[model samples]
Target: MRNKPPSLTESQYFLLAALLDGPLHGYGIIKATEQATDGRLRLAVGTLYGALDRLERARLVEADHEEIVDGRARRYYRLTNDGAAALQIEARRLQQAANVVIGRTRTAEA
Candidate 1:
């Protein structure tokens, strides 16, 4: 089997990370991602949907179908096993990146 594609942006990272907990609909995912990033990331509707489409195509996230909420259809998403594994890899990559920065910052301060 081929390896999963790497995350291309912070938004992609946020998307995968948000789904770490469980499945979420479009709006729920968006809100969770924004909050997780401390409001540093706010996805427009188009952007959010676009990312979802790409991720679903990649087999990372799958559409769980529509749920009626307040008399409206909301598309939900659930991470696949591959998606969870990918998220783990990305998290490790991010933690390593942070470690490098922290180490350098400490050395600079010292």
Candidate 2:
């Protein structure tokens, strides 16, 4: 039997998803996640950095590059191959869970 991928928290899931398109700086990730969730999740600066640090340590994400913008260093992060696989696994898990509710709701209505 295949080992199941580890589960992700909501913040971790969204953070990784934001990197799906490409590498993004901290602020870019915050904006992408907020937009993706329709402003439901606004990540504080500390929260964002904390999550990034954890993700980096886990090897799910990496610092792609750093650049100077307006005299400040901006770091860009990209999802590693393992990150993508984990994200996909989480997505499937969520979808299956949702389908159970939807199916039950439909049956009850019928």
Candidate 3:
């Protein structure tokens, strides 16, 4: 039997989702996540970088490239195929969980 993919944390899920469009630098990721969550998730710089490091090590994400901005190096990260697959699995899981409650609510309302 095939093993199920490990579940992702809320922050990790959002971080990967933020890169769905394309590669994004640190600040871009932060902004994208915030916008995606409608400001509900504001990733602190330290937390962002820490998660990025862990994701990188897991091979779910990689440093796509780097650029020097104002003498500081900016690294951009991109999601790997594995990461995309994991995200999809997590999304479906979340939908199914939500559906359970939604189904109950509808039944009660009827």
Evaluated with lDDT, which candidate comes out highest? 3
Candidates in order, TM-scores: namely 0.89, 0.95, 0.95
Q: Give me the displacement of residue 91 in model 2, in angstroms.
A: 0.2
Per-model tally of clashing residue pairs: 0, 0, 0
* Tens digit of per-residue lDDT, candidate 3, span 8-106: 999999999999999999999999999999999999999999999988877789999999999999999999988888899999999999999999999
Candidate 2 Cα outliers beyond 4 Å, as residue runs: 1-4
Off by over 4 Å in 3: 1-3
- Model 1, 1-110: lDDT tens digits are 15866575788778888888888888888899899989999989899999989988888899877878899888889888888887888888889999999999999999
What C-alpha lDDT does candidate 2 achieve relative to the native structure? 0.92
- How far out, in Å, is residue 17 in model 1? 1.3
